[model samples]
Target chain A: MVNYIKLIQNENMKIYRRVGTWIMLSFIVLIPILVSLVVLLAGGDDDTTSWPLIMLESYFLFSLIIIFTVVVSSDTVAGEFSRGTIKLLLIRPWSRSAILLSKYIATMMFALFFTIVAFIVTMLINLALFGSTSDSNDLGGIVSTGIVGWGDVLQYYLYQFVTLIIIVTFGFMMSSAFRSSGLAIGLSIGFLFAGNIITGLFAMADKVWVKYVLFMHLDLTSYMDGGTGPIPSHPMTLGFSLGVLAAYFAIFNLISWTVFRKRDITA
Target chain B: MSQAPIVRLQDVTKVIGKRTIIDRVSFEVRPGEVFGFLGPNGSGKTTTIRMMVGLMGLTSGDIHIGGHSIRTDFPKAIVQVGAIVENPEMYKFLTGYQNLLHYARMNSSITKERIQEAIELVGLQDRIHDKVKKYSLGMRQRLGVAQAIMHRPKLLVLDEPTNGLDPAGIRELRDYLRLLARDEGTAVVVSSHMLSEMELMCDRVAILQKGQIIDVRSIRGESGVGSKPTLEEVQFDVDHPDAALGILEGQGSGRISDGLLTLSSDRAGIAAINRRLVEAGINIYGIRVKTKSLEDQFLEMTGSETIG
Candidate 1:
């Protein structure tokens, strides 16, 4: 059997060699720095000591990270088909499942790399601009006194990353199912943005099944700061939300593997 | 004679959405020979190539490479085969060296020195570090051949390898393929719609029409030990074409075109005809014999309408 690591290396080479990947990566590093610089130059009350509050605001850039990852992951398999390189790849000594797994792993690695870069860049810039202060209760609701630490923020980022994985897997699924990068990317980002608004309407229905929807559970960070369901009126546990997300993740992977493994590469 | 066949397709059939694309096609290719899949466009040449490399599934039959079934033993079977199904679409962002390294890393046995050797083999040593986007089509073709032969596969399959190339480039590739087969004992498979190219490059050719193998014939030089006399088409450029036709007394059906009498005759028959024409004072200016080409035979076999 060929080493699966080499296959991932091959994929990573193709990904990083493109200039577009670098462009997306640059935005991750620049957007947060620019946002913090605006605070430094324009606002006087939001001083350097309130970095955590600024980070709370910066966490919204996860949407940007998610979109960037969606673009990269969406092109994982479909790009090869559109470029006609899939034939060369499929004819190698590896099996179809192995190749698919390598692509999947490589795309997730790309997501993780972006998330980590965003985390580091955002943390550094916020630390450099607004020094560490625990005065903000964007999560202060967890405690009656509105006091929290870095641990809660770390939990928030970690949970957000878990959702990122599920979303990346969804994009990978679409790429395999549709075999078109544009369609896969379109559906993935659309699911993220529109699903948020649509789930808000569905979350208000008060039905027992309302909590089981995918987008309702995507904001895993909502579980932070003593949060229950996305609907604050309806109480639920993190375990239930995790279970629903896990089920969708498993289904998405199953579809991707089945479709790609059995596909006829006529292109 | 002791060498076994490197590739064998047994009763292969392919059906795509109620349409039979390939129908019970079977053939074998031995090592050290260039076997051709000659057919018109949309004639399953690309489909068969895709199936051979396990890119497409087998509907009712199996292809064996190096005695390993491609349907079941894909990794084992495909490890012995090297192919380019269509155009050599490469990652244009990467250098030629990186592209070769990408494939080299797939197989564990290929080393860095082997990659350097392949680069030199394709004469891309100077431009090996340049991105593929800067490469000409002919250069890409050489790179394609280099990748296929680098791993030293037992079977090398190239589909429509001569799609766009100058005559000089085509001849160079033809000579190189022949040398690779002869020196390394690798069975080479080339698919082309042009009969003249296959006749010059292949040892044996399988003519396909509408997904069926209509004929499989040896296109190489026939051995002289056969019992049947070799026939040659001798053309006599004479002053009186009609008089030359009458001197023959209608022994052979001869065609007269542009003041030349052309007839199919053996060497001995040519001497007799020449003597008869000399006795008849037909004033023969030149007598030239030409070997028959497979173009006429291919046209007759496929009925000329299907050639693209």
Candidate 2:
């Protein structure tokens, strides 16, 4: 267990050391700035605009997380196997399952970090540009520019962040299954590209279960605003999406460990 | 060598697709011994090493590392074994120290002092802080070795560890590995195409050919005696000398050639022939022992004409 933790710590450090982390985070921060500029130029009413909308806009770039997460997690095993470093690690005392799980958890942790930072940056910008006009204290209190209450904004970020976790995990699953990093990235991006199309097609087929698919429920912002399809309309059932995602996460990791543990390190 | 076999493989077979990459190979390395795995490229040397450490699954048979079965107790078995498959692969973006730290962290028992000690052991202390991408091939190999032994594993498996090294670097690595085996009792398994290098470093060797081991025996003093020629003298460029063929044919021991008949005879016959060739006015420009090389043995076993 201790070895697994150390392995995860090491895996996380690889991301922090790479230039990609800052590059991705910087792009994330830029999204809100751009959205605020557009809104300010158009002279939109502050009362109707919600910070959560900016987060929803960040979803377009959410595929970036998918792409990056796939690259990071796929390489965690396949890269080592190709480079011949798997020999070094596997000959160690640690179990194969532990090693692979550590890598998976580390990638998820990084995704969470990226999501939180983007959420905080967007929330701050939203408050800086727009003042609170809603009545309830939950929506009325503000730190600066009289924006929405910290509690409300925090809840909003949590909702988006949870959705991001599902996306990150799905990316991890794809990356773990594929050998080539580019293939992993492409397949993950391809899913995001084809997801709405597939979901729409499936939805139109009139299957009641289409709403329960994890991919269909990824857009939490739209779902949170009384928009309903797959995700439960009530905010209280937000844990359901998280639960389905956890099941996917469990299966993905289980397969990765089983395959990778017994995988021939041919390279 | 100690009584305990530090690493052992029992009838291990690794098959990829329809091809058997390593077929039913078995061997053992005792503590404080340098076991060389000599073979041509694609002859299953690397595959067998991969199986030894459980980096790959065995289609058949089993391997035990310091008494733990790789199939059933892989974690315990693997803990005592340190291996480098092809090139010693490192995270190019990380410094050598950081690379070691990462590997060290995975093991938990490997302390910072142990990482430093391993770095020093590989003679890379001065350059240990530089990023691995900036390292030379020799440095990378050394770093790979450093990572392997950081936890002081009982068995160290190195595959073609001297591939890109210069003569001096090869010598340095050889000495370090020998010292590690002697002083620390680490059993080392090294596979290489360089017959002379293996002869210089290993105590015993398993010569593999075409996914099968041709021979596994003690190499010490075995090459220079018993009319077994040196690997270096196996090749000879001869001018047309039909008379030399008559002399060899008369001797009744070897194939007659255009000029050179590679004779596998007793020590007395070899010495007598050398004297007879000189006395018979043959243009004996060169005469030397022709010990079978790892490549020659591989070709003979696999019946391959093209050398890998």
Candidate 3:
């Protein structure tokens, strides 16, 4: 018991102070602002241009979450290694596993926070421009999707938190494996972008196993529609994707800790 | 000898890449003793210190700090030992106080007052509020020293602590270390190639050569009673430094350098050397008594050919 939460707090404070983190957060805010302006200026647009869709599609959606998670996690350990701070951190009384876990937890927290902030800003802008209520039902049958409810938003976010944790854990593993933050970030982003292309290619070829990969089901919105059961129209069950994601998380953490424990802090 | 030892190493050896960096070296640091370790470059000084602090594992050895084995009881041993290998690695973005506080939180027992005391001891009070990235090199070095003693460790290990320091800073560090040994009973192990600094700072010294302890002696006792010419007068010069080995003939140990001979001999025999060299018509331009600084002793013991 190394007071892991305090360690997380310590790491979070370090991240919060950095100019790069602030710039990334600012960019997260900028996206929905820009999207809302475009939607409002083109008034009388289709129902798809509503606030919830803007938030879901442009902010808390898979694309933005992937960007946020990749930035935070890839730089977590890689930046410390480059700055020569890992040696100081490692020589402390804590174990290797505890330190990595702290950074992982902090990255997850940042991802969730960024999502929430983006959601709020999009809601306010949507209300100001379209004179719409923040209720899910008013956001164009988003609540009537028949698979989720207003109260379940927190639970869905929680699951998304877990998914983000899995993704960021792998990012941290790559960070530990690579010395350059650019390479770690690039690899993470590339995987997120390329996984869909690979899945589509495999689906076109009738390869059934692509659905079970962790990359295929990172979208919590899809899970809300089916709830771990196989969607009638989709290829893989939600349970299978969740299982694969859990395995990836475990393997990533194991590899990260093992490498960090043995790494020479020559930098 | 009345008190327990603070740190001890037994048969420590570190091998890297088919080359033995540190041989089977053993020494005990008793409580309240300032033990100076003198050696030339590549003499395995940093390697030995790293093993002592458990920063690196020994190839074949056991290290005990404050009565705990470094391997089996690493937390207990490492908690009682504080070290700065070369330059202390710091979070440049964090203020000095914040950095120490972060390190302090890792150790549950270190108090705020103790951290303050460490900062004050290093004379960094005015700059402790500034970010470390903005601090001068000397200030950073002092902050490094502050961190090392923040926990009041039983043994404080510093490798070349005075490097890059002005003469005044060096003197300040030396005085602070002496105060630590005298007042707080903290064991200090310092490694440096600067012989004159060691001669003034250390009570006893261990001369290391090629990872082996060539000689271990007390500064007071080695010079003999009532100061026999300060260990400087017993030294003499010869014209044919290499050929003087035959002339010395079991009288003393010496080496040749650039057509000049520098040797340490007993008092009466040194007087005999002046007569022999002149009678042999060996042009000895430098016949005055030469002193053995810590550097001279280290080079001679290690038998290294290069000297600055």
Candidate 4:
């Protein structure tokens, strides 16, 4: 188990040591600040509460997070092959599954780290620019952000991160299954956006199977507003959406582990 | 040399896409020796090394390292082995120390002292903190050796380790490998296409040809002093080549060519033939013993196929 953590540490060093990764992270911080600056300088309303404003910015920020995390997750395994370093990594005492697991854990940890950075940065900037929510002694006192409580904002980020985890994991699976990093990145990102379009098309069909589509469950924020899902015609609950996404997360990881452990390391 | 084998391959084979890339190859590498896998291009040297290190799965048969089977007990078996398969490609963004640290972390037992010792062993202490991207190919190869030996594994496998090195770097690596085997009791498996380099470096060489080992023989006399060698080609530079050839005729495998008499004989045979030539009034000025290089035997065995 100690060796496993060290392997993850090695992977993190590889990921964080690169200038490109820091660029991705800096954009994660910079985009939120830029968005908040635009809102402040553009002269919005006086009663702009940070929770709702930050919530809106969170949507944009999470997209950038998805793109960043997808870039990292897709490159984690495939980059080793392209760089010809997989032989160095796999020849160690750990099994192939252990190496693959460590890479997965590291990428997922990177996604979580990016999310936390986005959360802290956006929350602090919006609250400072618009109003200080930290001064509020009561959780329910932020009435200016109408209808939704501050707790719902936290829930919104949590649900958004959960969705990001699923997408990043899908990207990771593509990484392990393909030898080329470019193809893995292209396919996973395409699947991330194309999933919604396909889900929308599936939503129009007069069939019950549309509710179980993986893309339909991605937007868990619909559940935060006490709504069924994107397709309100279907009776999809938060529990059902979570169940579907959970199944996919497992399947993606299964394919990744199976394909990775069986690979010949020909590169 | 009687030390128990550190790694043993028993009919280890690999078949890719219906083509036998390695055909039932078998050999044992003992501790405190430099074992060479000599072959030309497309001879399955890399494939066989890959199988021994478990980078590629075996189609049939098994490999044992430190009494553990690599086929079944891989994680346990691999702990005894440290290898750089084909190339020493590291994370270019990581510094040399970071690169060694990266590999050191893989096996939890390697300490900071071990890392420093490896850095010093490769003589990279001055530039150990520099990023690998700035390193020369020789420096990277040195850093590669540092990482491979970080764990002090019982078996060290290097495939074509001298590929991009200059002559000086090659000699440095050769000395370090020999030192590691002698002082640390490590079994070193090195594969290469350069027959002359192998002859200079290896204590024993297994000539591989077309996915099979044709011969495994000891490198005689070069191991140390007092080690006797078999019949070798000896050339005599004399005043009268014809008279010398006639004197040695039917007594030794002697023939006149290139204005000199070349004979196949051992030290004792050379001494006896020299006495006969001198008795016959043939002035034998110089009796130079020719080391039978593997190149001659390799070319004869493989029909002079090109080698690196």
Name the best candidate (by TM-score). Answer: 1
Local distance difference test, per candidate?
A: 0.84, 0.72, 0.74, 0.86
In terms of lDDT, which candidate is stronger, 1 or 3? 1
In candidate 1, list every pair of residues with a backbone clash: A48-A130, A48-A131, A137-A140
lDDT of 2 by residue, A1-267 (tens): 665678888888777888877888788788777977676777665444554444354554455665666667666756665566666666677777777778778887877777677666776776677654443322223212222456655565566566656555565665556656666666766776687687567656655666567676665555443445342433324466567667776776677667666667666
Model 3 lDDT per residue over B207-231, tens place: 8877888898787566656665433
* DockQ ranking from best candidate downward: 1, 4, 2, 3
Identify the superior model by TM-score, candidate 1 or candidate 3. 1
Candidate 2: lDDT of B296? 65
Question: Mind giving the per-residue lDDT tens digits that candidate 3 earns over A113-147?
Answer: 88787656765665566554334334444434432
Better of 2 and 4 by TM-score: 4
TM-score of chain B of 1: 0.94
Evaluated at residue B292, the lDDT of candidate 4 is: 49
Higher-ranked by lDDT: 1 or 2: 1
Candidate 3, residue A87: Cα displacement in angstroms equals 3.0
Q: What's the C-alpha lDDT at position B267 in model 3?
A: 61
Q: Could you say which candidate leads in lDDT?
A: 4
- Clashing residue pairs in candidate 2 are A132-A146, A211-A230, B229-B290, B229-B291, B230-B291
Give lDDT: candidate 4, residue A189.
Answer: 78
Fnat computed for model 1: 0.79
